[model samples]
Target: MERYFKRKTQPEILEPSPKSPKNNESSSKQTCVDSMEINSETLQYDPGLCTPILSYHPNVRDQVRRAYLQNKPCQPKTHAFPYTNFGTKPRRFNPAWFTQFPNWLEYSTSQDAAYCLCCYLFKPDIGDQSGGDTFVGVGFKNWKCKKKLEIHVGRPNSSHNSAWRNCEALLNQKQHIETVISKQTDQDRIDYRTRLGASVGVSRILLQQGLPFRGHDESENSLNQGNFLEILRWLRHSNEGIKAVTLENAPENLKLTSPDIQNDISSSISYEIISAITSDINDSLFSILVDESRDKSSKEQMAIVLRFVDKGHVIERFVGIEHVVDTKASSLKLAIDDFFSRHGLSISKLHGQGYDGVSNMQALVAVAKKNSEIGDLFTMVSSVVNIVVASSKRRDILREKHTHVVLEALENNELSSGQGFGDHKRFIAGIAKEGSRYCECNELGQYMQRMRESGWESLFDEVSSFCDKNRIKIPSMDDSFTSGERPNRKAHPITNVHRYRVDLFTDVIDKQLTELNDRFTEKNTKLLLCVACLSPINSFFAFDKEKLMRLAQFYPSDFSEHDLELLKEQLENYIWDMTSNSEFVDLKGISDLAQKMVGTKKDHTYPLVYLLLTLALILPVATASVERVFSAMNIVKNTLRNRMGDLWMNDCLVAYIEKDIFNSIEDEAIMQWFQNMKTRRGQLF
Candidate 1:
């Protein structure tokens, strides 16, 4: 090697020369000498400063000479023979015996053999042992050892020695695939794969790794195994759920999750997280923010969202969504209470309960329990039947009417003389039509029917004797069967037998009524005041007297004094002034915007308008979240869509979206927010 140095072209300058004029001869001589010296100096060449030719330096040269004597190279160097005195001739394939069939060039003796650098470095000598049948390829268990058995997960197959040795290999491959997917730039790369009904570029991963196959056991849930698809799922959710899907831990033999693998993973992991989070939460007291939502099917689905102090302020994680068959306040409260209990939590520990607008079901629940025949009991029983009615299976149970007939027949005796004397049929008919179910109580209906038959003459006597013994008196009432004249002029004969009805149907109407009032009309001045004491909140907040007086003009009543007083209280005190709220301010301005922007008028504030506005404020914030999730399911994880159960869908959504996530993940979420990667290397930048 040779080395030299030179400063890139730079100009030199002239300087005054020092001289003495002592003697003409000496001065002339000195002047000529000075001029000549000055001329020599002008060249200003310094061999010592020729950038030192670092290689030419005395100290370096001696060391270099010594090293050369020893036939050594500096820092790092490579030696190669320049030319060979003689070269051997190459052997040729014989065409005589080969027949020169295709007249093609000779074939190479090498196959496309490449080494997995990562495996070679971390697990040397593992190839020949694991190359399945030969040293040409790697087997599944070459690197696994007996001592590693405890730490290494094996196949369910008990053949301990045959258990896959390449778990680390598989895990490493998964890491690389995730890295590649993370580098993808196309926002819909996942969606594209999903639409084509192809794997999430998983096969590409195997191909990139030069692995012949992914080796998935169809019998074992692929999701359970750390397959590339699962990894892509993890990437999708992790990127969406967490801030990033990173390979920061991959090189360290650590893998993160599919954002919400919490939904599908082992309880041990969830428990560990809960314990970690709980141990860190202040006072070990977990604060909760719970609300209920409905699916497309409208099952009273309760979302158990949690808020607790993590490393910093309160973080709200949607723990999970629980589907409740009943939406009645008590039932809902009970369900929430039970959930808290199960999580080692308590209701009293509950700091807040967030729900949608308090309409019928909740308002009545918020109120005190009412008289058996009045608001409370009616609200309770009616809500029960409404729950049954809401379900298709249970709805069939009450349609038969066997249960309702028996109930109204038995209750007919309880009415005061003339009070509801002719309403038994109406009551039974009412029970028959509503959404309800009495399937479990069919035995009770049969017992009542037997009493109605002519053969059961002594049934009423036995009932009267038991009522006397139990100190329970049936209602005093005229014969409901004879309340009016029939064409035969005959009264219902056995109808006078002080009868009884099942407790279920007897309670459904008032509940629905209470719910209607609470949900639709509770905030209506007159209507709310009407059920003040009957409300779950009771008469705590006072309604404005002047407001009540103003609203009273809307109604016309020829009523009793007690009823009027009750009406006055409800009409005045049940006020939650939302008409002028901020949400409504936008509603008010919509009319103006329409006239200006699109030329329209906003008139009627139908109940639907209010409902939509309330939904916009509350409900959509909860359920509209499905838009993005369903989008992802269609695009990234469609393979599981139809197979998804209602409960599972909730889990998927929870993983797919975070808190206040609906509005956050608009169409722009895919384009503007996350950048998908094409490889782990892209992530390095």
Candidate 2:
């Protein structure tokens, strides 16, 4: 064992001074190594001060490699290299050598030698092809051997060439393994967002138009793969980027075009719209207008609308539809309760309840039916209309006769023409302008009363002239009248003048007056008159503080005694401000005034007054919104799509009825909402 140890010790001892000149070179190399320090930060750019690449700690090696590559080779082209003695001549580093090996050539000031930048950073540990570290470790001091630089580079497979390639790869981060993986992940996320966005955009359009999303056959070979898919294909074809990543181009699992996916996107969009509306409501008092109708599926669907003040403007939004087992009051109440609970609404916030106009019209029709003469007149008129409409020949003959009469009247100058025609059109347009219903009712009643009292002779004259022109015989007013019955001898007789004037003309007018009076009762008319007092027309000329206060008294729950007192004072200030301010001038209607008040921030100034305005606005003028919702239901849940689920149909109706709200919402918002609903196959972020 001692001899084995002695053999290893003897080689180490003999290695020190075997070659005297080589020993001296080794001492200088050792001294050079001792003078250098390797650090990642404050890296030594000078090649002479940099430690050998192989001597660096493994972890620090990469850091040094990157630092050296970034600083590049220290060529020192302008530096004056000191002269050194060769065999028989003086030699020194040449600046022109840098041009020959521009990338790898590096000059060190301390050692007065050249180095290889690429080899120093990445040269392998052991290989004959690696070109012994003359340029890397000891540095190249033999200026006479200028061709050694080319020799160090060697062949394509040489270590130095490999090191150079590695340096290039390090500089280009895109080629790094981590970067490649990250880019793939980022691209997938972007494609997912784009695909989802396209799907949402198509859904929004279909929902707005109340168009069906799916077709009967949706196979790949089918010509029509539903509205959702066909519209998506069209959109993809229109856009290059979208075309590259959606539908057929998308991944099998992440296409986002499945039926389930379309429903999810639609539900999300509906949720966002409801969220926006509720956010606008912000727990403010609101009235509910509900109406029930049977869908094509025969399901009793109840549509609910929210009428409230949003930003001081009266807004009526169709919040949702509910399916009830029956249309009974209890069933409807339960359905409404469930819907409100789900949507975070409180029943206490409901200020009023309104149903569709169908009930009122039915009541009026029933009243008319009770009157024998009125009932018979309506039946005969309806019969005539049906007869005229049911037969094509009769309709054609009627159209031709009417056209002939109109043409004859025009030629005879009995009808208005030219400027007179324009005046008549203006008169009709004026009647169409929006006005208080109560005011219109009163005006109509007064107009009818005037026509009844004094306009009969003019009507009689016109009738006589029309009969004469048409070559029909006219009965004399003084002649006896007889019923055209089977037994004419037994019929009661009356004068023609009394029969036509009293029985026909006066009877019809009196029935119309009674119906009008019954429809607009004294109490209801007074309430409407009070409501109209708040109208912002004629610079609020209709504004009456006492009348508005009286209107407030009608809703005692909304306004307390203290509120009424405050409202009285506020109303005085409100009317003065409205009449004087130019912003309130020329306001088209109550809605316009509400918007203007909110725009001018006056709603914040007079809280009580604004509250009154909201209350007035919330009163359902007509069940137009509810009627429109049921109309949309007929279109969305038609015979073809009658099998749609209740929840799905409601979502479609909400989107279809509130198109303005749907349009205002962004696709990105809807996409984010869908993403957060649950863990999806593809990330939308």
Identify the leading candidate in terms of lDDT.
2
- Residue-level lDDT of model 2, residues 247-366, one tens digit each, is 678988778888778877887888888878877877688889989899999988888999897875667899988878888888887667546534546555677777664565465466
Candidate 2 global TM-score: 0.63
TM-scores, all models, native as reference: 0.22, 0.63
Which regions in candidate 2 have their CA more than 4 angstroms from the true location? Answer: 1-186, 358-366, 369-377, 380-402, 409-481, 486-523, 536-543, 575-596, 599-605
Candidate 1 C-alpha error for residue 15, in Å:
80
lDDT of 1: 0.33
lDDT of 2 at 654: 86
Give the Å error, residue 473, model 1: 26
* lDDT of every predicted structure (CA atoms): 0.33, 0.74
